[model samples]
Target: MLEQGDQIGFLIVSGTFLTAMMGTFIVAMVVLHRQRQVQNRQKIDNLKSEYEKTLLNIENEIQQETLTQVGRELHDNIGQLLSLAKLNLNSAKPEKQAEGKEFINQIIKEVRALSKTLNLDWVEEISMDDFIRQQLHRIESTGYCQTLFDSDQSFNELSKDSKLVMIRVIQECLNNAIKHASPDQIQIKIYKEDSLRKIDIIDNGRGFDTSIQSRGSGMTNLKKRMETIGGSILLSSVPGKGTHITLSLAF
Candidate 1:
């Protein structure tokens, strides 16, 4: 019933309509892909910002804690020993003059030794386990969270700088939890696995949402600090379930 000219015209219109629809679909897909890419880039930028902020907090804490701890050692340990030696020398009996002279010599040697290592962290290596335990005990006495340290193999092989950075990172994290998270407990674990060093920090605190950007810059600064030292930090947390941070680096 249709004329040839009319049928031909209808076919052309149908083809044109279909082509436009396909073009629209392709264009829409390209726009969507671009939007997704932009969103992803923004997300990564935000994460970097957060990491930098946390690192700053860590650096500040390190300076403060290092100064405080060293001051303490210089005061409590070395100073007290020097005082005792002086007292003993003053009380030496006349009959024991030779022995007193020998004792005074020993005290001088000890005072010299302690003075040499007091402010200098380098020069020699120390047992990391013993060091960590001592640091934690010192922190715990400040009426902060109950701190615990556990390590399978004593991490005594790390360089002085590495140990200092790692300790500073841990120190910053603990301070954040106490000052911000308001956690009830804090735990530190250090271990060597397959030639790598791992430090796990767990806290039972008010908890936070990692999805939301941290209002306090402590988390961000800590992450950046680790990265600068050839280390990586993973922060995973859940609301009401506390927060956990795992740090890894080559020792």
Candidate 2:
């Protein structure tokens, strides 16, 4: 019953309806995909929490073992060696006093060397600068990144928890660069910006598109860690340009 023109119009309407239906399907798919991502992230967070607990337990065990070893070495080796050195000096003649002094100096040097490898208990005796430098030593040994840490006096003023979080976040950043970015240089700077404390972790390496997929599990874990302590993280990265991670923690 329709005219030729009306028939063509009907076809056009049908095509438009089909296109709308396809768009609606695509939108639904997108929504469902996002939901899946949310669920996956929740699972990852749970796993990360378990991982942290395990990490703490392992670290505690290693520290206990380290202290035991140090105690044994001090008692059986260094302590006895020092006593022997002192006895040698105490029983030495005037001509041999110089030799005893040389031996004492040698023993002192050995003690200083052992002091470098002494296990540190962060929960007890950790300074902010020491923590940062400790992380730097870890990243540098990997040979993939050379990281530098600079901080203002405000860094020392932060709470101990904040200091620990900052160190841990920077540690994660460096781990990502080594494990993923393959960066050659990474520089970390922490200072006060107004009422908040800021940490900047900059790396000169091949970056990636965060819009696509963030392949750095370390970064995602780092973000969750920061958020647990009432902090936030911002990442600026471009393909081949490099990565800059900025963390802001409240007082």
Candidate 3:
């Protein structure tokens, strides 16, 4: 019933309406997409902040542990050396002077070594392999277990954040082995495979079945810490045999 002009007018109006709707829809989509992107970025920032805070807490705990160990060394080892040196010097015997001097020099050396552990600055300067070896050596010196470290190459190529996470994981693994596993020997091996860096901690201890539930928080914490660093951990154990923990990180 409409004339030619009316049809053309109707078509133009319909076309304009559709074009406006499409333009509005596209603007809405863009806004929504931008909002989602902002939210995702905020989430990432929050996660990063949490990771940094946790890492800081770990560093503080490590520092306290180091200080405690330093105190023990001072009280038990260096103190005894100094006392012996003083007693030798007090005798006033010319022949014993050399022995007293040597003891004093030894005490000085021990003090210097302990001083380095008073702070965590050295951690930044040392390679991961060296750090692991140092930790194992501390355990070995306790006479509770025989510890060994083997590495295919140094892990200094890793980022500082990665190293911090790795250190915490290794420490936790070592402590767990020493405390619960009751292992006579503990060994750590570090190597690179393809684009991944792997660390294995093996202990010859009475291991528990993986199927069983554990009441301890150590394993849970270990898993969480590894996850924060974008790494993965695998645990294997056999009753009456031993336990092995492998930590893998992409380089």
Q: Each candidate's TM vs. the true structure?
A: 0.54, 0.52, 0.90
**lDDT of each structure?**
0.72, 0.74, 0.88
Q: What lDDT is obtained when candidate 3 is compared to the true structure?
A: 0.88
The TM-score that candidate 1 achieves is 0.54
Model 3 C-alpha lDDT per residue in residues 128-245, reported as the tens digit of each score: 8888888888888989899888898647677777777888888889888888899999999988888988999999999999999998887888888888888889999999899999
Candidate 2 lDDT:
0.74
Better of 2 and 3 by TM-score: 3
Measured with C-alpha atoms, the lDDT of residue 132 in candidate 3 is 85
> What lDDT is reached at residue 91 by model 2?
70
Q: Candidate 1's residue-wise lDDT over 145-240, tens digit each?
A: 688878885456766555666767776677677776777678888877786788888888878888888567766666677776678898888888
Off by over 4 Å in 2: 1-120, 137-145, 215-217
Per-candidate count of clashing residue pairs (backbone under 3 Å): 11, 0, 0
Please report, as a residue range, the 10-residue window in candidate 3 with the lowest summed lDDT: 153-162
Error of 3 at 132 (Å): 2.4
Model 1 whole-model lDDT (C-alpha atoms): 0.72
What lDDT score is found at residue 21 in candidate 1? 97
